[model samples]
Target: MRRMDTKTTTEKTGETGDNAESPEGAGSAGADIAAKTTEPVEAAEAAPAVEPLDADALGPADEVDKDDDEDDDEALFPDEAPASASAGIGGAAAAVVSAALGVVALTGTWTGKVVAERETLIGQIKTSGSGTPAQQISEIYADAWHSVALVNGVLSLVALLVAVLVLALPGRPSWVRAVAVAGAVLGGLGLLLSVGTYFDLFLNLPTAGS
Candidate 1:
């Protein structure tokens, strides 16, 4: 019985030793597999990254995009050209009419002055004359001069109003604006002068008999 026990114990020890050696061999194999898997991953990570595309090098696509943008701008601006020209013409016409009316006002003012001066001179001559033909002629001319002054004053006032309306209008050109401003100034002055002359002529009219 003792000898059988010894042989069994030796056989068990030999089996345990083989089991330990098998575990070591398995561990070495597992480490080699892990190392191989990690090497490929590290190599991929270490490689240089791909460069992004440059905007300047987008050759045909960028040019096509720029051409489309230019076409859009042309569509927006150039198509409405005629309407802008028409507006400019209208603005110029209004300024011209206002300037012409200013000239008319200035002319009426000058005419009023001439009539007023003649009436005054005639009145003086009539006072100096006594039951003479010249006195009769002076009386008739004085009435005509007074009538002329009234008409001239009304005409000048109309011109002044027209000029003011033109100035109030929109989109005037540079030259047109200059002319309108000049018209306004001259028309205003002439309006005041003519109004005063008309009033004076009426007040200083010769008595009906003279």
Candidate 2:
């Protein structure tokens, strides 16, 4: 009986020790897990800061971009066309106008009729409506118009001759220039005579064929 009692006491003591050891091991394991979780959080909070990107740090790429922009500007604008074509057109228009005026003066009976009226050698012109009287007056004036035409032709011929001689002169003599001036004066005189004759035709002559 005594041996049996001793064995029971030993067994009881062993169970109590096992129960205490299990509780201590569970507490230590829970503490270790909590430390592991909080340690990662602390490390994350103490991490180093990251730097921000700056535009000025782009280096040679910025210069290349500026150069490209300048090249684009140069390509957009070009030089203007020259003024020679416009000047040539203006000069040609002036020449055409001069030619038109010259043609009108040449073809129209502007000078001959005027000269015919001033000459008394033709005879007195009648303003009367009598057809024969008017016809005779026009006939008389017709001769004067012809004479005026001859005078103009002769003056033009003299002018041409003087111009030729002057141009031929090696020294371009003053006398040759004087001859040209004289020819111009004579031509003016002829035109004056034509104007006077035309005035007479209107004044002394009839309005119509009569």
Candidate 3:
């Protein structure tokens, strides 16, 4: 009977210890699970929110790129610069031409000499048949002189008009303007001389007796 009682006491002690250990293990597992679940939730709450990017915000790099594109476009076309250069060259040429025409008028031209000769021939033919000595001299020599004067006057007038036109144009170079002024002055002088010669104001016709 004593042996049986001892065995029964030992079995009861073991069952009581097991029940206490089970409750402790269960509490530790529940605590670990709760910590793991709350860790993810706290991290989500602590993280910063993301914002959308603004479309209209341009930085310095973007502006630089835009400027480079514009410069490339100007290089590709390149029309305006050449056109202006060509216009300047044309104006300079016209100024030179006006000056040359003025000089030609002041001097004598082959065309003027040819015209004078033709007029002289015509006058001689007309007066050779019937005319006094004074009439013949007036018709032949005076007519030829007037014809040359007329040709020179026309050339001078043309030069004067061209020079005036060049002066009236805007944005001419300084050298071009100076040359044009000279051409105008020479043309005016030539025209005056031509007029005087044509009207016989410079040298009158010889008398029939002389």
Q: Highest TM-score: give the candidate number.
A: 3
Best by lDDT: 3
Q: Give the least accurate 10-residue stretch of model 1, judged by summed lDDT.
A: 201-210
Report the C-alpha lDDT of model 2 over 134-166, residue by residue, as the tens digit. Answer: 565566665566556554554444444444443
As a whole number from 0 to 100, the lDDT of residue 146 in candidate 2 is 56
Give per-residue CA lDDT, model 3, range 119-168, as digits (tens).
Answer: 88888888888988987887788888998999999989888988898899
- Estimate every model's Cα lDDT from 0 to 1: 0.70, 0.55, 0.88
lDDT of 1 by residue, 138-168 (tens): 5655555655657665665665666666668
Q: Count clashing pairs, candidate 2.
A: 5
Give the number of colliding residue pairs in candidate 3: 0
Candidate 3: which pairs clash? none
For all predicted structures, in order, the TM-scores are 0.43, 0.27, 0.69
Model 3 regions more than 4 Å off: 1-81
Better of 2 and 3 by TM-score: 3
